[model samples]
Target: MAAVDAAADLLLTAARLPDRDGLVDIAVVGDRIASNGPASVAARGAIDLGGRLVTPGLVESHIHLDKALLSDRVSTTAGTLEEAIRVTAQAKRSFTVDDVRGRARRVLDMAVRNGTTAVRSHVEVDPGVGLTGLEALLPVREEYAPALDLQLCAFAQEGIIRAPGTEGLLRRALQMGADLIGGCPYTDSDPIGHIRTVFALATAFGVDADFHVDFSDEPLHMHVREIADQTVRLGWQGRVVVGHVTELAAIPPFEQDTVVAELAAAGVAVVCLPATDLYLMGRGDDINIRRGLAPIRRLLAAGVPVALASNNIRNPFTPVGTADLALLTFLVAVAAHMGSPADLRALVDTITVHPARMLRLPDYGLVPGCRADLVVWECARAEDIPATLPARTLVLKRGRVTVEAEHRVVERWR
Candidate 1:
C-alpha cells in the first residue's frame, strides 16, 4: 500500500469498491484521489459508507437534449422513426432559447441526481433550427460544471446533403464552442456522401465524430461499414462513435462478426440506445417482433467498446424516460438476456468505464491519482445494481459533495 497522506480534504472510510471484497479508505486531497487503501489518516471531513458499493460516476455517451421532453406537446400515431423525425422537425420551428434551456436543465438535474457525472448530448444543427439548440445548451454546460461535465455535440439530425446549408451550419456550431460533431446517415439521401462530409468536418476541426447509423428493424441500411473504412482512412481511430446500429441484430452471426471486426480494428466505439430502438423499431411486425438492438454480446466478446445510453427522454423517439442510467442497465439485462452475475456487473461498466473511455474523459476512475468523481450506491454488491435498481447514497464530483440522498423502506404488515 502507498503511504497515506497526513491530512486530506475529504476522506471516505469503510467504502466498498466494486469487484473487490472488504472495505478500504479513500483519501481525497484537493480535486484528485490521493490514496485508496487501509489508511489511518486525518481529514477535515469524512463519511463512513457502511460497506455500500462504491463505483465511479456514471457517463451518458449519446443523448438528445434539444429534442427531449416533447412527448406531451407532440402526439405520435405511428411510432416509426420516420414519423418521429417528421414530427420533431415540425416542432423545432417553434422552439425558443429559453424553452430549450429550461427543458435541458430539467434533464441535466435528473441525470446528476441519478449519479451521472458526465454526459455527451447531441444538439441539433440544421437549416430549420439553425444553432438555437447549441446556443441554448452552451450556458447550461457551465452552469452544471460544478456537478457535471457536459459535452455538447453539434448534430446534423437532418441529412447534410439534402438539408442545404447544413454543412456550413455545422461548421458554425463547432466554432461556437461545440465539443464535437455528429451525423445521421440513415436520414441522408446519399448515406456515403454524408459520412464523407462529416469526416471532412471532423478532420478540419480536429474533433471527434459520432454518428447515428443503421437504426431500423431490418438490415436495409448498414452504413457502419463505410464509417469504419473512413475512420481508418482518416486516422480517426479511437475518435469516432456510432449509436443505434440496431440493424446489426438482423444480420447473420457470421456476417455480423465481419462488421464487428472492422469496427474493432478501426477503434470505433458503439452506443446502444435500448429505449429508442425498442420503441421505434418492429412497428411493422405483427408476430414475433424482433428485439431491434445491436449485437451487444458479440461486440463485447470481440473486444469492441460498447455503451448503453438513454438516447431520449419523454420524446417522440422514446415516449418515456427518466434519464436514469441504472434503469437502462436493468432493461439490457432482460432484453439482451444478460442475466449472469458477471454480465450484470459488466452492464454497470457500460454506463461507467465504457462511456468514459468513449468520451476520452481524462483522469476518470476509482484508482489513486484519478479524478475524485465517485458514487456510493445503496446496494452492497455491484451485481445487485442491475438486478435491483438501488438508490444512490452519495455523489461526489472532484472530491466535493454534489448530491446526497437517503433510501428507506418500512414493511407495514411484517
Candidate 2:
C-alpha cells in the first residue's frame, strides 16, 4: 500500500475569511491554498484560528523603495510634496547598495509582518547610478519572490522619455527584467512630451505603464485626462494605472465625474496614496485644509477601479508609517467618507483584488488553483480590522509558513 503523505506544511481552521461571509478552515499544502471548508477539512495538523478574520494579504500598488530607504536621513518640517522630493534628491547622492537594501528590507519586513503579500515598487533609475540599485535589489527581490510577490517598476524619476539617455536606461532596465515602466509626468519639466515619450516606450518594451500623474492640489492640473486619452488611443486599456490622482478631487464636481467616466471607459485604474498625501499636500494653509487623498469613494461610486497604497513609508514627506492596510483603511475611510459596514467590506477590494488586476497578478486570491499567498488576520469581522489591527495569526507564502506571529504576553513589572 502507498504510504499516506504526513508532512503538510500549514493548516488554519475556524477563520472568518474576508472575501466572503462565513467561518471556514483553510489548508495549505504546497505553495497554494490546498482547500478551504469546515474544520473537518483533512490536513496533517490544523491551527485553531479561534474565529479570526482572514483575508488575502494586502497589496501595496505604488511605492518608492529608493526613497523609502532615504527616509531616515531626511526630515520635512514644512511637509510639502515638493520638499520631500528635494530631500530625496539630496539623499540619493549618498546612498550605497547596502544602505538601500538595509532600509528597504526593514520596510518589507514590516509589510510582511503586517500581512502584505504583494507590492509594486517604483525604483528610480538615475542617470549616473544607472540600474545599480535595481540590480543590487534583484537577489533580495528574488529571495522574497515567492513569499512577497514583488514587481519592480524601473522608473525614470527624471522623466525617461523626455530626458536624454534615460530612454536607453529604461530600455536596459526592461531588458534586465523590470516588470513595469513608470513615469512622473507632472513633475517632468515638459509634462506632455514626457507622457508622449513614455507611452511610446511602454509600447516598444511591451511592459505595463504606471505613472505618478497630476499629484497636485490645483484643479487646472488635469493631466489625468491626457493620460486617459493617450491610453485609449494606444488601446492600452487595463494595462495602464495612474497613481495619486489628487487633482480629481480638486476638480469641479461635474468635470470629476466626466473624468472618471472617461478613465473607466479607457480601462484605467486609479491608485490613492493616503499616507503620503495627508502629510505632503495642502500644508502651510491656515484654512481650507486639504486631506490630500484621492477621491476614492467618488471613483468607486462611478464604477472606476481604484486602489489604495502606502506610498511613502517613513519617508521625508511623512516620518511615520506601518506597512499595515488597516491603518490605510482607517485613514481612507475618514478621508473618503467610507462610513458604512458595507463600504468597509468593499474597500478590501481596493487593497486586494483591485491591485491584483492592476499588476496583472495571476491566481493571487484565495481560491482553487491559486498561489497560496495568504494571511490570517486574527480579527472577528471585517470592520474589526480597524479596531484590532492584529498581525497575521498565521502566514502562508506559497503554501509554506514563512513567518507566524508568536502569541506570547510579556508582563512588565515596575
RMSD per candidate (Å) reads 0.9, 3.1
lDDT of 2 by residue, 137-231 (tens): 76678877756988899887776544678878888888888888888887777888888877888999888899998887776567888989999
Per-residue lDDT, model 2, residue 314, is 83
Off by over 4 Å in 2: 1-10, 19-21, 39-41, 410-414
Error of 1 at 221 (Å): 1.3
Quick one: RMSD of model 2? 3.1
Q: Model 2 — which ten-residue stretch has the worst lDDT?
A: 1-10
Please give the CA lDDT of all the candidate structures.
0.94, 0.78
Model 1 ranges off by over 4 Å: none
The candidate that achieves the highest TM-score relative to the unseen native structure: 1
- Give lDDT for model 1: 0.94
After best superposition, candidate 2 residue 84: deviation in angstroms? 1.6
Clash tally, candidates in order: 0, 4
lDDT of 1 by residue, 115-218 (tens): 99999999999999999999999999999999989999999999999999999999999999999999999999999999999999999999999999999888
Q: For each candidate, what TM-score against the reference?
A: 0.99, 0.93
Which consecutive 10 residues in model 1 have the weakest lDDT in total?
1-10
